[model samples]
Every structure is written in C-alpha cells, then in structure tokens.
Target: MHIPDGYLSPQTAGGLWALMVPVWYAAGYKVKKTLSARQAPLVAIAAAFSFVIMMFNLPLPGGTTGHAVGGTIIAIIIGPWAAVIAISVSLTIQALFFGDGGILALGANCFNIGFVLPVTGYYTYRLLSRGAAEDSPRRWFAAGIGAYVGLNLAALITAVEFGLQGDLFKAADGSALYSPYGLSTAIPAMMIPHMAVVGVIEAVMTSLIFVFLLRNNPSLLHSYDGIRAAATGRLQLKPLLIGMALLLVCVPLGLLATGSAWGEWGAEEIQADVGYVPQGMDRYLGRWSGILPDYAFPAAEEADTGEEPAGAVSLEGVKESVPGYMVSGVVGLALVGGLAWFSTRLLTRRSRKKEQLD
Candidate 1:
C-alpha cells in the first residue's frame, strides 16, 4: 500500500522519518558485516524483484487495488537487515521516479513495507522453520505463513497510520486535514481486502519463490547455516535474471486493475467523496510530480480531451500505454538494481576498509 503525499500530515511523515533514519543506518551496519562479495549482488537482484512484483497489482475487494510486496522472500533469502536495504531501495525509486508512493511519505511507506514486513516475516519463519532440514517442506510452509502474517500486519499498520491522521490532525471546522478515514473506516477498508485477498497472494508468491530456491539453490537462504557454500556451487544468477526479465515484460498487466488503493485517491476524488479536501493535504497535493508519473511516459500531446484524465486506467488507456509501461518497467528495474548494487558495494567496501585499519 503506497500512501500518496497528501494522505499523511507532515508531522506524521517527519516522525516516521526520524524513526527510520536510525533503522536505515543500523541496516547498513548489519548488512556490511554480513554481506559477502558473492552476496552483494543478491541484494540488488532482490530489490529489482521486489520492485517488479509491486508493479503487478491485484484487484482487491471494495473496488480498490493492491499488490504483493516481496519483502518476506527477500528477508528469507538474505536477512531482515538486507531486506531493509533492498526494499527501501525499491520503494525510493518508485516514489522518486514513478510516483507510486509519495516523496514526502517515503519514510512511512518504508516503515510499513520495508522494515515491518520483512522483520515480521523473518522472525515468523525463523520461529517455525527452526530445526527443519535444508530441503524440508515445513520450512517453505513456514515461509508462506510468515508472508501472510507479515503482509497483513504491514497493512494493518498502514491502516492505523491513515486512521490516526483523521483524528489527530484536523481543521478548525472539525474536518480532517489529511486522511479523512478514521480508525473504524480505515481499518476495515484496508484490512478486509488485505486479509481476504492480498495477503493470500503475497503468501503464495513467497512460498513459490522459497520452493524454487530450495530446489535450485538452498544455500541462498541466509538463515540456513546448515546449507553453506561447501555443498553448493557458485550462486546462479541466470535463472533469477530470466525470471525478472519475463516479469518486466509482463508488467503492463498491472493496468488491468480497476481502482486506486484506499489511501491513494487524488485531490479530485477526495473532493468528490468527502465534499472537500483537507487544508494541509491540499497544500501538499502533487508536491512533487514524478518524472514518469504513474509509470508512463508523458504523451507528446494529450491522449484525449474528455471527462476522464488522459492517463486514466481503462481498456483503451492500457492498450495505448502498454509500450510506455513496459519501458518504464525496464527503467525501474535497472535503476533499483543498479542502486541496490551500489549501496551494497559502498557499505561492504567501507566495512572492508575499517577492517584493514583495525
């Protein structure tokens, strides 16, 4: 669930950022200590994988849309700390370039999906997958359940954040100044779909990936100390690369979803639904229109002169925008992948230098 800019009060956004800054630093410290030369690129691949998976939106109940964040699988394969790095990278790129999430709210988004999702799943899997053999079915089962739990928990937290905004921050007229949905409305609106549908999709995705890795390269699972490199050959990138390439090509399928997510409605939609825009939210709306807003290249000219927005999601819009969407997917993949790699390289290199000095 990507919270758009206007959905959150600046106080909420800033508080989340203050909490996240130390978490981010600690993630780097942990990843640098644990990430080996061979493991560095794995984080990059995981970041790109997470980014692309998030593009494939699924239709949720109440006419809203949602997607599977692959944070749990990344945590399983690497570690929760590295998952933070990988997921944060993916989310930052999406917010800055594609307008998937808000630039100001990136920290809050990362807190929900990047940190909470991975850490929840990682610990859940660890608790259940403990003492299971490298190739055990129990482990993957644990991973699936962990994913379901993690995704739902993250969604619940997101709902709470949006819910609190309505009550905590308000105009003099007693209208909400940010998100208009209070706890009762926001929680059910978010939780019902996630619990019924989105969480299941996330669990299935994680289980399948974990199964694939188990069959192909069990050693890639960092938490499994029993299956070290002594038994396995060099980590194979070709299979993972092929899978990501195919997903990139098919990203346009995400346009098939019909509605925006619950907390991601635009200003006009907010006005129509609630009778007015919040004062604070109005000021922050479209605070930063991303380069490739909503993952499409701007048309040379407006595609239409009609009631709906030119970039509105429809069958015709999907048909027209497929090429741009695919290109955007490719661009996102490269940016997240490269930036993730660079982050690992920088952190690991710094750790190495410190060791040399010692």
Candidate 2:
C-alpha cells in the first residue's frame, strides 16, 4: 500500500517524518543488540532476495496487480531493523534506476513497508507462535497467520492515511462519499482483498524461506529460531510443497501485474476515489507512494504513458535515496571484504617483522 503524493498534507507528511526518525533509531539499536557474525552474510543475501522478488509483479483478477512485500521474510531472516535497512536500500534502487517510485516519497515508502510492516510483523509472529514447538505444525501455522495479518493491518493503516490526506471518502455533508467505486468503497475494496492475497503470499514465502535457512543454515535463523523453534519443531521440506502452491498462485498473479489485467481491475476501484484521476497513475500504479502511512509522489509523465518530462523528479535530483544503493554495494563490499583482507596481510607482515626482531 503505497501512499501517492497529493494524498498527504505538508503538515501530516512532516509529522510522519518526525515520528519515523525515532522509530528508525530504535530499529537500528535493536539490530545492534541482536546482530551476530554469521548473520552478516545472511543480511546481504536477504537484501538481494528482497530486490529480486519485487521485480516480478503478479496480476490480479482485478485490473490491478500486486507483488510480495518481502517485509515479513526479511524480518524473519534478519530482525526487523535490518529488514528496514534492506528494504529501504532495495526501494532506492528501484526508484532511482528504474523510475518506478517518486523520489519525493522515498522516506514515506521506507517508513510504511520497511518500518511498519516488519516491526509489526515481527511482534505479531512472536505473539502467535508463543507456545508452539520448533518445526511444530502449530508454530508454522502461527507464523503464516501472523505474517498474513500483519500485512493487512499495515495496509489498512495506509488506506486510512490516504482517506485523511486526499479526502478519500469525505462527502460535502461530511458523510461517506459515494462512488461507482469511491474512497469509502476503495478502502476496503482495494485493501482487504489485495492485502489478503498479499498476506497469503507473504505467509507462505516466510515459512518456506524460514525452513530453507533452518535446514541449510541454522545460524541465519538465529534471531528468532530460539523462539520459533521452541514453538515449532525444526524447519523441514513440507513447507516447500506449500511454498510451491503459493508460488504457482504468485506466478499467474505476477503475469497479470505486468500485463493489462491488473490495471483494469485495480484501476476501476482506484479511479472512483480520485477528484481527477491523474494520467500519471497508469504508470506509477503500485509504485505511487513511498510505502504506506505516508505519501510517496506518484511517478509523473507529460502525457500519461511515456518517458517523464525534464521537470519531473529524477535519479540525480533524488540523491539522498540513491547514494547508499549506488555506492554502498561497492563500498560495503570493500570495507567488509577488502579491508578485512588488507588488514590481515598488514598484521601478518608486522608479525613477520617481530620475528625478525626476535
């Protein structure tokens, strides 16, 4: 649930930013407390997974399409803080390079999908899996349900934000506005079913990835395995079959997202809410808002469906969001990998010099 620009007032947008800073700090602090050595590689891998999965959009029966949020999966693998960082980085890449989302709304998007989804999803999973054994059917079931529900909750919050900012459902008399598909209808119409389908996708994907990492690399699951394994049994292959079924559903959905089907379905519902449905929306669709609970500027075009014009926000204009994505991948590798190698060699030479001294 991305909040398109124009949905939020400047005051509301700024207030959200003020609130988000503290939350981001808290998330990072928690990550520092929980991080471990083996977890580092897994963090990088999870970031990569988030990047790739979002690329494949699924079509819905409705004209609109949806894709996996990856928030729950990342949270399951690397605590919610790290998940936020990962998703934020991935989103920056998508927006800057691909022009999928608006530059003005990156922070909003980060807070919604990155912070809201994962933080909420993590605690929810814990609450649901409270008493299950490791690999127990109960734990798995709890995890899936928790993930599914968490996404919907986040989506609902996002819808409300839209309603507040854009007058999504206000009538002249201050009653619920009516539409062939107005904001009143769009809120539940778009959010409930869309989020439900997404929740299932998230749940199965989380379970599968959880199982995979558990069997092949238990260390990767270290953060929550203590709690999760205590509830379930151990990760196993049965979820693989479940994952496949979910994936099958996802494939057709992704095809539809990239195709015209998603547009026809989702557009009808969304269009009913707009004071004047901007043509730019046809391209921005899912990428319109930053994440949820905030406004991300919708992608803009001069004439509906073509390249953006000169005045539109561009990769160069949105430097805050891109630097980390463009440079961090290389710099992080160098500092984490190259520096380690160089430091080792320097230490070895010093030791050799000490031997000569001896």
Provide the lowest-lDDT 10-residue window in model 2: 293-302
Candidate 1 C-alpha lDDT tens digits along 131-187: 988788999999999999999999999999999998899899999999998999999
How well does candidate 2 score on lDDT at residue 268? 49
TM-score of 1: 0.94
How many clashes (backbone atoms < 3 Å, residues ≥3 apart in a chain or on different chains) does model 2 have?
30
- lDDT (C-alpha) at residue 196 in model 2: 60
At residue 267, what lDDT does model 1 achieve? 93
Query: lDDT for model 1, on a 0 to 1 scale?
Result: 0.87
TM-score of each: 0.94, 0.62
For candidate 2, lDDT tens digit of each residue in 1-358?
5444333444555666677778767765665555433234445545555654564465455435566776776676667777776666666555554444445455666677767877788778778777766666655566676677767776766555555543443435553222223357557755756566766788897787666655665544545443234223333434433543353333322222333212122444446545434343444344432222111122322222434452243443333323333333333333323332332233235433543566
* lDDT of every predicted structure (CA atoms): 0.87, 0.52
